[model samples]
Target: MKRYARILAFGAALAATVISSSAAQAETILKASHQFPGGKGDIRDEMVQLIAREVAAAKVGLTIQVFPGSSLFKPNDQWNAVTRGLLDITSFPLDYASGRHPEFSATLMPGLVGNFDRAMRLNDSPFMKNIKSIIEKQGAIVIADAWLSGAFASKKGCITAPDTMKGQVIRAAGPAFEEMLAAAGASIGSMPSSEIYSGMQTGVLDAANTSSASFVSYRLFEQVKCLTAPGENALWFMYEPVLMSKRIFEGLNADQQKAILAAGEKAEAYFNEEVRKGDQLMIDTFKKAGVEVVEMSKADYDAWLAIAKQSAYKNFAAKVPGGEKLIEEALAVK
Candidate 1:
């Protein structure tokens, strides 16, 4: 009888232990938000969605719930949400928070990133290191680094040289670009990229500058009369990264964290492969719509760069602390 009692007690203890372990390993769900069209092949939305799929496949008790097209949070408001842990993850445009951190203006500075190759190099350069450090200090960390090449579209005419910007009201994505456009004699209006189509439709915007993917996804080809596609010397490039709340990430178990990191790597690789295709698709979509498409000539790019140096570059160097050094670091990437 004593032996039987001991065996029963051992079985009970094992059952309790198993229950405890299962409870400890309960599924964790992370909420991710972005301002891009969901289920429509927008690469930005797909990046977050891909991470969700990859992490779930790892079976590490992690799940990601994505809220795209600003359903969960406003586009410009997402940065603060991630920092404060209100949102677990986000696909954020770094420049949208330039007002909070002046140094971020450098991320979207005019003519800073000329093309995709330089963008990849800049990811590993001191410039991005500094930017990432700031992100960490602010309670967020970059999961995937994405640089999107953009173009200028106008209902008025093609925006090629600084002189062409005269008498046009344009939506430049960041302060640095705003300074350059204003110097080039274009009127500046502040709005998120998601609103560009409506802004133009309502006659509030005569021209706009944004990512090729956004231009395509938002169907801006229907609104603008002329599209300045990014050619060899692309001028507009912005760093839009997948970001996670540092506190939330740190709270995750080791297996969960590993899954998240691996997913991020996959998402970054996917973006690099698909981004160029997005640009071409925008060009084709616009041309098929009968909207005139043009590219900036080498001379035209040089002219814009000279104007940016005088206005955007000069102002950034003078205003933001260590801003000049940041620009120098990016330029040194070659």
Candidate 2:
């Protein structure tokens, strides 16, 4: 009987040691990358930091390492990298992945989303659900939902009127907007926003379209002489969501998934609030920089919309499968 009791005690000790070893080795690590600068000031950076804070506070045996300003991957490469598991997550603009899914180009369709409230409703909207469905199949999921409104800038003059862009070189953020700019008779320049600075300086770009926040963040105001800001409502609205690879997310335990998702949702709310304020803040930044700033007027906006209908809208419906249904769903959002 004494010998039997000793064996039982030894078995209990071994079980406890095994459990402790499992606990020590169970940490889940996520590598997050983005094109925006991290640390502070910038909204994306701040939100990502907030997410990290919340994760740490939860103590879910999970940790995420952040790489900002394309340190880990280029802006265009981040999406595919996340899907390939070379990256775990990214703060990505969907339009950049339009090549992977042409339907994604609709996210940047002119006048589709002009303000925060309408833009915020997109994730649940049927139109966006369809888009998300396609993205989910490609091995990624949106952990955060945020939209950014954009504006146009020119080197010598404002691109307020469609006719004004005649014969000028321009960068129109994405293909949809690019089609509109091309219809306006502007020669389209293909490059990322980071390249826009040097492009403008070297006479490669006469006018460029980008997010309101980027206008100030990239300091293009210092490089360009004229800035067109989103005033009240603008045609350029891009859906920039932080996406996580489905394989990595599904690999987490329920507790870890819950904690990370909750953090991501909170970060998205913070991002939306920052983006709303950023529109006006960028305009102010440009004005103070001694740059001539112009807001798109209603008449010019209407004219641009007319051009877009013939260019971007028509092309999307003809080219992308189910594009017509998506457009109808988006237009019926109101």
Candidate 3:
């Protein structure tokens, strides 16, 4: 009887231990948020999903819970939410935060950084290192950087020269963009991309500037009749920052950090490829939609660059601490 009793006690103890161990192995949930609608199927969402998959594969006890379409916060509030640890991760355009960190406006500066290859190199270069330190000071870590090709859409007609843009009511997103359009003699109304389509249909806007992805996502093609050529003035290559709260990142173990970084690298590569392919598809779609694609003259492009160098850079430098240094480093990245 004593031996049977001992055997029962041992079995119970082993079962309890197994249950506790299993509980401990359960995945930790990390919440990620973005401003886009969940159904949009944008590249940003794809990258987040990729990270979640990688985390699961590594069996690191980490799981990502994505909050799409700004359910937790609006697009402009995303940075603050992430920094305050309300969101574990987020990806957004750096230009959106220029009011908080004016140097970030450099990311949208006209004629500053052109082409994906050059932009990618600059992202990993010393320029990003400095920018990263600044962002960290605000309580977030920038893990990946990417550029989306921008284009101009007009409700009335195509604009092929700076002179033709005069008196146009153009909807632009950032101060630098507003300045660029203003320099080209267009009347500027700054608004979020979400508001652009309606702004055009109601005649609140005559032109709008955005990426090809945006044109399609917002269905702006239905209202706009033309798309400026891809390479002309490089439109406005928006830079996206893949960021996480500093506290969340620091709490991770070393091995976990390695997995996150590795996954981020893969996400970055995939993002670049997707943006390129998406741009081409958008171009083809625009052509099929009967949108006239026009390229600006070299002289006009040069004139715009000269104006940006003199006015935009100076205005931006005055607003941001160490802004000129940031610009110099970015331009020097080659």
Top model number, TM-score: 1
**Which scores better on lDDT, 1 or 2?**
1
TM-score of 2: 0.92
What tens digits encode model 3's per-residue C-alpha lDDT throughout 26-54?
Answer: 65788888765566757777787788788
**What order do candidates take by lDDT, descending?**
1, 2, 3
Ranked by TM-score, top first: 1, 2, 3
For model 1, the local distance difference test gives 0.94
Residues 1-334, model 1: lDDT tens digits: 9999999999999999999899667978899999999998999999999999999999988989999999999999999999999999999999999999999998898888988888999999889999999999999999999999999999989888789999999999999899989988999989999999999999999999999999999999889899999898888999999999999999999999999999999999999988979889999999999999999999999998998999999999999899999989988888
Question: Which stretches in model 1 have alpha-carbon errors above 4 Å?
Answer: 1-25
Question: Each candidate's TM vs. the true structure?
Answer: 0.93, 0.92, 0.90
Residue 258, model 1: Cα distance from true site in angstroms? 0.5
TM accuracy, model 3:
0.90
Cα RMSD for candidates in order: 3.5, 4.0, 3.0
Weakest lDDT window of 10 consecutive positions for candidate 2: 37-46
